[model samples]
Target chain A: MPKLIDFKLILTNIPDLLQYLPITLGIVLLSMVVGLVLALGIALVRLHKIPVLNQIFTVLVSFVRGTPLLVQLYLSYYGVPIALRYWNYYNHTNFNINHVPAFLFVFVAFAINEAAYNSENIRGALLSVDDGEIEAAETLGMTGWQILRRITIPEALVVALPTLGNQFISLIKGTSLAFVAGVIEMTAEGQIIAGRTFRYFEVYLSLAIIYWALTVITEILIRLIEKRINRFRVAQHLVGTPAPTETPIVGAQVLASKEVRS
Target chain B: MITIEHLAKKFDDHQIFSDINLEIQTGEIIGIIGPSGSGKSTLLRCLNLLETPDAGTITIDDQQIVAPHITKAQRLKFRQASTMVFQQFNLFRQKNAWENVAEGLITVKKIPKDEAKARALQELDRVGLAPYANFYPEQLSGGQKQRVAIARSLATDAKLLLLDEPTSALDLELVGEVLQTLKQVVLDHPNFTVILVSHELGFVQEVASRVLFFDDGRIQEAGTPDEVLVHPQHERTKQFLARFATQTVHN
Candidate 1:
């Protein structure tokens, strides 16, 4: 810990790390957005549990979940080049392996990985939706799609949000993996600075510290959101219903914050 | 508003019901009575296309909901007119009572949000649950929940309501409150149809304009309560009535 502690090198790299913050955040943001969209599609496919599509998602989820993240990144970065040679051979076009940017491989790999994990998160959320609720929606004449959007998805979002938040924070940390693919993110930029300045311990310690700080921030943010959602609105009828509300007819304490009505 | 012709439903190898035919006139309240194993539920579900008949056709409000190779979209259109209220009152757990009520209106009828909410409140009020509008089903009592279920059906503006033993799940005192809600609604709303399956004869007599005595898997006798309960023709009808009459007296 003491050998690599040059105050000057650490100070210079701290600013550099801050500069790379956008690159790190940008990748996290971009991959998460694209990954979530794909995840929704995959989640839907799994939810409907159609014969072919369910099988596809099953295989896809298992495959992504089974392999290590590092390997997935390495395969995308190294393997895509060989695959494109086939494209080049067939199309008679000059498809240089080098032209395939490092960022693209990293993004694609991250997106795929995020989608796999998020799909499982979302699918579990969808399943947790009460069957009675869906049946009630059915009686209301809600189409299958409408039920998913109106009651099923929104309710699932309440359940899925926390898990998704965790994934997102992990995803930001997962951006560290992007360093392997040569995409210049905060973790990687830290690595480059550490190697150059021979202050390996300080640089890595800084990276670990930032990641830990981020995790803590996300945890606090998620907890705040959970509280806000609870505070901002109780069950629709819960509004003004009163504290230690009338023992509901069924004789259970049902989250009755009646004063707060959406 | 509904017609059933030679309708039959079989669950795999077991024939649940067969050779059932009935004409439900517009605005008629018919109570379907039967024992535990009887196919009263299967019949009600068939009318709404919630359970497809193995053989036969159901025409509701002059539209065929079940026919040879009918499209699901067309069948769903018929479901809009008839809502089935379950014995356990399967209100959506995620939604509050009002969302449960407004769901069909907004989703199937494409009613606007404000309009749907307004209508849902009105229906809940109709069932004496205006205050419980925003309450989730889990929060409501067995009686309150059933009223919400009834309100959900009413909110859709469905002309026909199918109660599959609507009050069977409630306790002695609770049952009357739900039945009273239904009775009040019946008195106030004209051009509404109700087909109920129940073991409670007094309730059947109170709400059903006519009653059918079912035994095994078929309708053994069909007539007004005076005819079926008071002057029954079938042995099974007589048997059911004797039990019902005694139970009513004791309860």
Candidate 2:
């Protein structure tokens, strides 16, 4: 009789699955970079409520958010080649749809999916900045672009960072769907190894362990970054800091007497 | 010099102020006092085009802006002519005291970074905040934050300064430091026109060279503090001062 369980196969499957780890990470890294840029653009368009473009992007973001990632990957994978064929026929161009890489479709789908979710996170953060500070900046004669660059965006980033970090973790798990586009990432590699060995449970368990470890690492890195950026807040909680120079009691009384109406 | 004519504003159906007219001489400290919803703060905001008036024109120095038709250049020029201190002491939370003071200098005035830093330090020094230059808004007390805000406005070198209830958010004890700083600013820069809206009747009386009693979206009374705060000509002005009278005695 065949052995009931191949406990050793789980260990052996990890290194084999690890071979394709870079591909999975590559999709996440590239998509994160592209998605962040797209999200910022979408958030700004929505925040400012710019004309027709705002409505167009609003619907586009809704559709991406409402639909499943796998469906999105399938649509881009199958849809782009057909669209390209129609374009080549109409434009009288000789573009080759067959030469397009599978990973490009996966990258496009993941980035769009990430942008739709992250834009809301960014918009909330942008709105969270105090109106008072922006007014102060405006009163200082800073232009619209100057206020956004110097004051709004920097302040908004502090508010957005934690949510954006969570989005990144979700994006990592979302990249598992890359196999739907025919790209053999870690998940796809696990399935291939499972199919050959008929040890599906063991192979998947190893894959889960790797993904869990990756998530843990990402969380730690995000926390470190948060602590570093929030250093200015450290002084407020310190127990024994030196007091500020001005004597509050004396200052108040002198001001009241010297400047009072009576 | 500043001139306002037929100024008006409304939030939907609720009118904030309307058909307001006034002329302000250069180098004058103008105190505006009124009830809570009397549009005093909105009027100060309208002067710097912070609130876009629905109908009116504001002329500051050589630049003039008519409501609903303010050009970008006109708004920029008007803003450059004045700065504001908020009641909340709205210092940038992300920056230190010196950076807050230096921000307008570097970003708006396009001064060199080192020179801007020096000027910012000088302004902070004027407010007695030079030692706390590295402190963030959260690290400082309410009064210190306001002083940093004052330093920021002063460093811009705007001819006009608008203070909206500057000490209203401070602790009773902390109010004096901000009041002292404002008194010094007025004494040090006699040419800098200040438009202050405050419930601190005492400070307004001490610092304001001319006073305006704003109510129902109009200047109900305008004169020296003695005329409005002491010998008020309007019934509403007298009633307003009377309410403060009881509060002062209670304190």
Candidate 3:
């Protein structure tokens, strides 16, 4: 029988798989940027309850969240060419679907999926801001846009950072699924190496090790960012001295010495 | 001067206040005292156009805002002419004390950063909070936070200041510090108009030039502090004072 486990193969497979790491990281970074912009748009729509578009996005976000990401990936990979063909037929345009990169399909699917999840997180963070602070800003003559940019968004960002960091880590891992669309990332490369060598268990274990290392690195970076962002909160616990209890000011003796304003 | 005519507001079916008419002189410290839900806070909010009055004409200095017909520019102008200090302090949590004070000058007035910072520090100094200018709201005590809020309002250079239950949220011991700061503010800027809504009858009587007793969506009595607080004539006013009297004795 062939060796039950090719431990040596596992070690050798890692170097070849590392070459595809850039593709996976690139997808995560680009998708995160695009996903955040789209998520903010969706979050604001839901937050302000904009008329018809709100309802449309509400259903769209719901659909994306409810369906499996794998199914969405397949739909993006297969659905875009048909969509472009119809567009070209109706609009008399010569946009060739064949020229579109496979990575584009993978990117669209991942970005939309990420957006649906992050929009809720963003909306919750936005809502968590105190109404009193907004009112105070308005009273100070801050325009609606000024209040949003200066006060609301900054405050919401602090609340959203940790969850957003988690989302990014998940995105890094989720890039493994890019193989579903013909774009060979780290995991896909691992699969190819395994197929040629027939060291399936060893190759899969190496891929797991690579993913585990990526997750660990991502976690360390997120924690550092969280600490930096929460610098304001660090000194907060130092203060809370016990307040001296005095008589409630319901009706203390109206002091004769204090000149009554007339 | 500020003049209000036929000011009214309601939430769905409940009427907050209606047919309200009042006149306020520049430099006057007008105190409004009322029971909970008597619409005193809403009345203060309408002066700054924070809450739209269902029907009314409000004239603050030369700017006139006729409700239900206010343009965005008119509303902005009205808010710019006055500032408010909330009971909750409402200092921007992300910003330090100095930033909270400077934010209005920098953003609304469009002043240069260095000039705004200087003015903010000056305002903080006036409130005896210059030392704590670098502290965030979470790092300050309740009294300190309210003082920072007062500084922020003062820094805007608004002629009229609206304080809605400013000390209602403070600890009993902390209330004296905020009231003292307010008293000093009144003395320092005698020409700065203030409309204070509070349940602290003693503080109102001490600082208010005139007092209005509100009940059942109306100004039941408006007179000198002695007339309104000590020698109330209206039945509702007397009944309200009587409740406080009972509480004072119980405490």
Candidate 4:
């Protein structure tokens, strides 16, 4: 039988596949930015338990989270245009589905999927902020938005960072699903190269190595960011740093004869 | 001056406190002592509208808010009039000591950054935390954190300051330092009124001008510490004092 894997071809295919990295990175970065913004709104709506909008978001997030990403891609690709066409016809607008770029469907599908998961992360992080801190801010006479901006969001972001980094990395891998929408991203390009070369084992091996490297690189960068963000916390746990005391009020005031330690 | 009249609060079917009336003069240090779940903290909270009373009128200086009828403007005005020091020493965890002290000044009172920083540093110095001003809350001992909390309250220059169990969360060694700082605060800032909720009868007797003994969701006894702490009138008050006395002796 022929060799199950051709090691030479795997080495040669590495550069050809590496070029597709930008396509994967582009989709992931765009989806992350859009997804994070939308997630904030969605998280707030549910957190405040707004009258009706919260329930609508509940259904939307549930649908996206419950279904498979591939199915979501199909729905975005096929379903969104039909819905938009009906929307245009009924509203008497001259909009056309052809005007929407095909790749936009992939972006929408991945972005919405990431939003569904990240909203929970954001919401949980915000909720984890101590009730005492919120009370402290209020007692300090800080307005609600000021407290959110200064106290709540900063503390919550610290709590949410690692989880958010994990979600972003997952989203990077998730971009491989973009091939479902006919987007020529990394995995899609790999498939085309493999079909032409008939060296499936070598091409597939190269693809795996590229993805492994991407995951490892993303993890290292995220760790560095986390360390920078939590630098204060790092200093907090160091021991033997003597607490320096300010001088007593009276330069010549004698200590009280009776020390009240009760 | 602070006045609370016919104050009431209820959580669903459980009544927390009702018809609570109090009058505090400027510079008065009133100690509140009670068993757990006596609504002492809630009473303090209602003064600043932190926990809106179901029925009552709270007046600080001239701004008065009636329960269930307070406007947002009135709420803000009332909240601005007082500051609270929590048992947890709820210094903003993300901020260092100076920022925690200066945040209210810069954001609420619109003080200039340079001026607020100077004032914050002075307050930190007052609390004997000058050198630790750059440290985060988690870096400081519980006593240091409480001192920072006290400094933050003092820096706001609020007419009334409420402290809920300031030393209850501290180590035995730490409690003495915090109590000393508090005594200094009362002596130095004679114009600032204080309501301290505490379990340390010795400290309360030493520092407070008056003591209020809370029981059954009401102030059963209110008198000079000599009367309330030394010469209790009500049977419940005597029982409560007796229990605290034994606990202290055992400790």
Writing each residue's lDDT as its tens digit, candidate 2 over A1-262 gives: 8887899998999999999999999999999999988998999999999999899889999999899888999999999899999999999998897789999999999899888898999999999999999999999988999999988988888889999999999888888889888999999999998889899999989999999999999999999988877755634532223334674533433333343334
lDDT of 3 by residue, A1-262 (tens): 8768878888888989999999999999999999998998999999989999899999999999999888999999999999999999999999988799999999999999889999999999999999999999999988988998999988888899889988998899889889999899999998888788878899889989998999899889988977876656634442443322242211111211121221
**Cα lDDT of all candidates, in order?**
0.80, 0.89, 0.89, 0.86
- Label model 2 with its docking quality class: acceptable
Instruction: State in Å the error of residue B78, model 1.
Output: 1.7
Strongest candidate by TM-score: 3
Output the worst ten-in-a-row residue range by lDDT, candidate 2 chain A: A234-243
The ten-residue window of minimal lDDT in model 4 chain B covers B130-139
Number of the candidate with higher DockQ, 2 or 3: 2
Residue pairs that clash (backbone atoms under 3 angstroms), model 4: none
Q: Write the per-residue lDDT of candidate 2 for residues B169-221, one digit (tens) a residue.
A: 98899899899999999999999999999999988999899999998888999
Return the TM-score for each candidate structure. 0.86, 0.90, 0.91, 0.89
**What digit string (tens of lDDT, one per residue) describes model 4 on residues A1-262?**
9877789989888888878888889888988899988998899889999989999989999999899998999999998899898998899997888888877999899889888899999999999999899999998888888898888888888889899999988887788888888888888888899999888878878888988898899999989987876755734342224542443422111111111111
Q: What is the DockQ ranking, best to worst?
A: 2, 4, 1, 3
Interface RMSD of each: 7.6, 6.6, 9.3, 6.1
Off by over 4 Å in 1: A1-12, A88-99, A158-162, A225-262, B238-251
Give the residue spans of candidate 2 off by over 4 A: A1-16, A194-202, A235-262
